[model samples]
Target: MNSFDSSIETYLSNLHFGHLATRSIASIADLYTFKGLVLIPVLWWMWFQHDERREWRREMVFATLFSGLAALVVGRLLTHWLPFRVRPVYNAELHLQFAGSDLNDALLSNWSSFPSDHAMLWMAVATGIFLVSRRIGVLAILYTALFICLPRAYLGFHYPTDLLVGAAVGIVIAYVMTRDAIRVRYATPALRWIERHPAPSGMLAFVLCLELVTQFDELRTLASSVVRNL
Candidate 1:
């Protein structure tokens, strides 16, 4: 077998065994689901419950949420168009073997496999949350890494490379957006627009634009090559 085929074989071996072990662990899915449900409310309590941060707390809260969503959507679409990859269950082609999951159904698989949305989204959220409060951010990332991302690989929803790349994308997006948010905090025009519009509008516009950019064949080929190298 060629190198690519060999890689797939390795993935399959790891995945089959991994799932058997994963079932034994207290479900990572449950941990992530609970975290997702409580993430926002908990963050709110952290920000406002502190009597000391009365003024700056609200601003920081808005920045973190707005920047996190923007990063997730932008990062997800940018990575999707690159090198269309077949997911695990659809391995009829025998091109690449992926981890198969018993927990999250293979039927939920979408196009492309190089970057995982869950990884990116959670990483982005954790990153933004971290920028606002070091204590909270550290906990969020720890929870995400332990529960959300590791389970994805254990269940075969994504490859190790996919998770790593998705995380890098998330971090970059979060850093960039957060930096911009900081600038906007000081800029009069930006502050005015942000106050006038809801938090979702900027993020929504970014997602639409990302969709358009990924449609071009020239850019798609460029992205495919980049991901292949990674």
Candidate 2:
């Protein structure tokens, strides 16, 4: 396993190009990891505008949110329990090739790179969406592989195995969350509560959007601090 990881990282790190095109591709890929948030508004519109698909739309939204949240919780727990693993960029033994200034020294200071949180969340969302609509699910899975996971690996943020394990965990979480027993036991009650309380739900959604768009760095810093202090 170690040999396989090192070989792949070596091959990829050797292929780095210091060009504007490569930088652009890496930047676009970084953005697309968080692009699942874009579905919120689109699903919102579909829920109201397309009455016939309202049930499906609602399920889709619920699945996405639930899966993403579950992935984060599970991924973080695993990271905390597992031994620390340095990212390729920070590992002294590895040759890391970064294309642009987007990846800075401070970003590479952490040693929590065993399982990628980004891959876990995005893959979970993709799998959840797949359970809702096959076409969108297939697209989401492709996006996760091509745009989200590959770019991170290309940039030396994670080893390929980190993504594979994280993605597997995500898929499992999505499947568990979509189970009929789990849905009836948890999701139904939660959805009913949200439906009964619009103001709080809207406020929560606003806060989530704000955090995702503007305060993600701060949130990540806080989360890291909590994990370290634990």
Best by TM-score: 2
RMSD score of candidate 2 (Å)? 3.2
TM-score of each: 0.63, 0.83
For residues 99-137, write the lDDT of model 1, one tens digit per residue: 443454533454666677666766776787787778988
Those runs of model 1 whose alpha carbons end farther than 4 Å from true positions after fitting are: 1-27, 30-32, 92-107, 180-230
Q: Per-residue lDDT for 18-106 in model 2, tens only? A: 68767766675556335555444443444355577665566556766677777877877888899988888777666555553356457
Task: Score candidate 1 by TM-score against the native.
Answer: 0.63
Listing every candidate in turn, what is its Cα RMSD in Å to the true structure after a full C-alpha superposition?
Answer: 8.9, 3.2
> Clashing pairs in model 1?
none
How big is the positional error of residue 62 in model 1, measured in Å on the Cα after superposition?
1.4
lDDT of the structure predicted as candidate 1: 0.58
